[model samples]
Target: MKEKTPISLHEIEGVVVGHRDGHGFIVRDDGQPDLYLPPNEMRAVLHKDRVRARIVRHDRRGRPEARVTEILVRSETPIIGRLLYENGVWLVAPEDKRYGQDVLIPKGATGTAQPGQVVVVELTEPPALFGQPVGRIKEVLGDIDDPGMEIEIAVRKYGVPHQFSEGALAEARALPDKVRAVDRRGRVDLTDVPLVTIDGEDARDFDDAVYCEPARVGRGKGWRLLVAIADVSHYVRNGAPLDIDAYDRATSVYFPRRVIPMLPEKLSNGLCSLNPGVDRLCMVCDMLIDAKGEIHAYQFYPAVMHSHQRFTYTEVAAILQNTRGPEAQRHAALVPHLLNLHDVFRALLAAREARGAVDLETVETQIVCDEAGRILRIEPRTRNDAHRMIEEAMLAANVCAAEFIASHRHPCLYRVHERPSADKVELLREFLKALGVPLTVPDAPGPRDFQAISKATADRPDAPQIHQMLLRSMQQAMYSPHNVGHFGLAYEAYTHFTSPIRRYPDLLVHRVIKALLKDGRYHLPVLPVPGEALAKLAKRLQERGTSEAMTRSRGRPSQEVLGWEAAGLHCSANERRADEASRDVEAWLKCKYMREHLGEEFTGTVTAVTSFGLFVTLDSLYVEGLVHITELGGEYFRHDERRQELRGERTGVRYTLGSKVAVQVSRVDLDGRRIDFRLVRDDAAGEARPSGAGTGEPSARRGMAASSLRSAKRAGPKANSGKSGTGKATPARATRGAGKAAGAQSPGSGRGRRPRG
Candidate 1:
């Protein structure tokens, strides 16, 4: 056989990074840490281009930045921001921040859209010494404040699309509403087997169902496990409209009050949905996982499984708890087995822990709406046994999916989170040590070490603070071709083979699995249409933006040598987008909800402490309202990042995340998508005059305030910090620390705090 050439040796021709994003192209070269583009040498590279370059002189900070020597290829397409007439000369600001400059829109170049409105403008001319690229508006998206406007803004801002092609839509509409008889020809029929879907009460699209039975192992041990995933590939063929759309999206974006689904509603909520009593096709992961939580043997096959009951998390939890409720007797026969399933879940959960899986339980909030589309509640939904049981089952299936795919030599999208770089991990360890939590092996801190640290500080009142820090220390996960094991989940190999109905990655995995089963080369997952294109644009913009952000900062330029940075950036941005969208919707609804109770007070906990203000989660309403830093108390407070707390200089009363207090709704700005909460003591909240700027500093201090607040009224820390403070792990508490010296909060940051009646 001929020797395979190293990928590094290949000359990638015609590929160029746009020096100016989505407008013109430029050459970009490879290097570590910061990839530099020489001022004049940055002529041809676009946003993302893979080109060969020669190393120039090192930067001032000792990084090997380079200039592009040649162009390899151009990225997909150009997407420009809306153009507007400024003074007399027309100018349009690029929606993408990476572009870094406004494209000069000449007079008569703009379409019907006036200035201020975001639009898609194309470049008519490349950058010249005197003039920038010229462009005209292609489509006009209204002012950013329109209803559901955030989603549209995000889509345009991130290059995500809202419309499916007429062909794709037509393709979906023509498909049958239910699984055709011929579709189940070769699948196993389990319609009468009593499989049931257990999900949140509001879950409209069910993609999974479980049914467990006790079975004897060879010697005398026993096992109980059954995980059935919607068989997407069985019904949706490769390259079909449904499959194509799903592949493009790769994952469903669940923003509050809305869902941007990978599959169309028809498939997501109807046919492909695993609704109760429906003969839905499923790709079942039938396994005999023993008490050790080890999968003894597993098989994957297409089957027709009927979900006998559609149970909500609340209902299932009640049944499992044997509560005297309607659901307890509704599924009476299944209660015992459900409890058995919970036991098996517990065993598997223990097994997962034994395997060094990092169980990070972050709080998840749900938005509740009334008939008028107003937010009635924004509760922090606790993870009941039902949710954990589902999670455990999914985790088991994902592990098996990873093993099976690798065993079959198949390429697929993996949910991978790599470990932090040695330096960053060291910095994190230093931060922990400075805060009084010492790390035994500082240099090489892995998931188990984190778990150990968490366990050690489990009982501390400062547990939430420490857990938040540890989580921030870890990288976020993303889809990848290579499965190098999930660093966060503590899995050796893992892929999302469940939830094909909502997540595009899972759908793609199904396609890959089917292809692998047929001994075919697995096709690569596509970024949904503009999805990939937008992702490429987003990545370039993010890299440049992050690099720019690094300068004039405290921490070392994030070690790009750690591939996890890219993963983290992607996930973090997605998380931010999801958050922004969710918050926007919830804020709108909450603003509407709060309109009815403007003068009423609600008990809330300080879920977060930031320089900008404190975010309070109400106890009874489950709604989160913001108390501008000015609303904390009638005193000056300094924000301590190292300790993750806000301290009052006059009162010595520090408020950190988990602090409890009562607050009256001061004001809700639906236009700005912001809610203001004043202290329970605020007497003239509505009549009070506007204050200086408020700081948005995250709680990194005041970890010990929980103990102090016991005497004072507090809400949450309501039940517990998501798994972060679980067990007995409690880090040391010192109001003062080594590395970071506390700084006074900027006067502007103390915006909302005012004396209430």
Candidate 2:
């Protein structure tokens, strides 16, 4: 008998990504190109599953294909979805669109969840090549329109750690409600220092209190600024349950009407919160700022301080605007200190400008939610002088903390914002050139150069697009053990030390500072070795600039440095996750709100011009929707990549970024979180191209010849086909005067708009 030869299979680990159309791909952890997985192969695993796959032959597209050999790790995370039954089959459709497949529920696996009811499902059986994965309802999250349902879905959809572990809860419950005398033994007693916390009107957790006064330093007079941060490290010791929970969350996630706090309320809003009229233990950064706004000297120490008052931003802004106002008169004694703080803030602002910080003015909107968690309104959140003053003070304190640790040669997570890459600079230059804007960007541009471009284009018709492109060119800020300097703020060094109550990195900074004050070194608890797949995934995420996960270098390092590196990666990744989760909740809420105003007409500006469609933001509603190319009139529109515009092939009519037009709310897909608009008027499309120039035609009907029609078919008929009579029904004539002589409106101007006042 001939011996049977064994076939050796080469396997690699990667994450599964399921598509809405039932196909799937394996995003390799090793940074290689994604491997294609047909629908047949995807039946064996679910999206986000870490699996070991064997490489199969290449597909027709020359793409490496793979088949799942072994499921290394199931997601195990419960999915939130709505229960449905059709044709004697029970299934759960995930609320998050990223999960493409539905879970099969057995007869009794539905638990107490009824049809159309939202519930959390836990997988009971892993998927097989021919059978669907079976799951049982684990929790009932109530109806879809219940109060705070969006937030609930977001928290679960993004895998946010919402519920505190029993151990963590117990540890928090056992903590004292106030600063004890024994705990303040070695701390400086600044109880009568008259420091005060200034925050928003609705703020509950006060993490910082500030006080400033004129003082003499060296050869000149300076301001003595004291910033007292809640001493979270004192309560959450290393390796404790509370500390573990805080580390897991990394940072608090804030939604419109809710906040998933890092620490339990017992600590975040009680003992560690620097509430007014209460004595709280704190870590203080005492700085002597010269009249020029430079920190001449600084010191850090542990202290017990009492906040004399809690002032809101409105009250402080009113007092600063007019010191003799009623609000200022009400806090007569604190007025002098407030004025001193404002003076210091002015000096700091001048210094910031001198340092060449990139200051891009963006209007931030805040959602005002009612008691039932429905959005009452969304208004621009204007930053007043009081807000700026507090921010400057915090920035100064953070800089001092960073400098202190760096001087001590201690490793800690620094807030780093690296300069833009070479490719980004070239893209921005090309975009600017296409818009006929001057490219004043330097070969190696700093914040000042970008700032110049923004200032020069401030009043231009395409200023919004220009500013947006510039902003997108910059890298996101991240926490790293290495100090790469912050490009946006133009700071040499920076760290977070003021918000320890909500941020884990700030707590670590507080711990390191306290250790430095005591002439000791801070030590981190031992962390388990990260899995090979996780390390590779983290490295890939870091390289793609999508996230900073477990990205510590594999090089052998001293225990302390290794600890700091790992902590930095974890904190950075969690920060990004929190942001994604918060945005998901907001997007979902916005979609729900817009569902009510369907079919209404609203004027909007072109925020982004893509080949597929134009993304427009309504002037007064502040809601954004996509105007598909098909709805841009009965003409084939060709995308101009560099110019960021869409031009009609026949009429040569153009729709560029920042162009304003009237649009009627057409379709709202709540499941997809998408809104679509149809042009109510398109005079913003500009004039037709001359007959001889390019492929310009006088009318949509005569424009598409045999050759042109063939070319249009390649770009998708729904997108580019505009043969008027040959087309079915002529697309309803574009709402009568939709493409009439409406004049163009410049960027940031509400021209041609009839938005609500």
Q: What is the C-alpha lDDT of each candidate?
A: 0.59, 0.75
Q: What is the Cα-based lDDT of residue 568 in candidate 2? A: 77
- Candidate 2 on 1-757: residue-level lDDT in tens? 3232222387877888776545677878777777778778888888888888877777443557788888888886688999999999999998765566788999988888999999999998878877777899999999998998888888887778999999999998898877777998988999989899999887878999999999997888889999999989999988888888888888888877688999999998899999988899999999999999999999888899999999999999999999999998999999999999999999999998888888776656667778998878766677799888999999999999999999987889999999998878887887888877866566678988887888889997567668988898899888887787889888889898889888889998988888888899888876443353246535634565522333346533445655676777788787888877766666667778777766665666777776556777776767777766667766666677677777776666677777766666666666656677766532345322222212212222221212433333322222111122212222322322121011111112111100000
For lDDT, the strongest prediction is 2
Estimated TM-score for each candidate? 0.68, 0.85
User: For model 1, how does the per-residue alpha-carbon lDDT over 22-53 read when each residue is reduced to its tens digit?
Assistant: 23222322222333455455444445444666
- The list of candidate 1 runs beyond 4 A from truth reads 1-31, 35-120, 123-134, 367-377, 515-757
Error of 1 at 3 (Å): 38
How much does candidate 1 score in TM-score? 0.68
Judged by whole-model lDDT over C-alpha atoms, candidate 1 comes out at 0.59
Question: Local error of candidate 2 at 379, Å?
Answer: 1.3
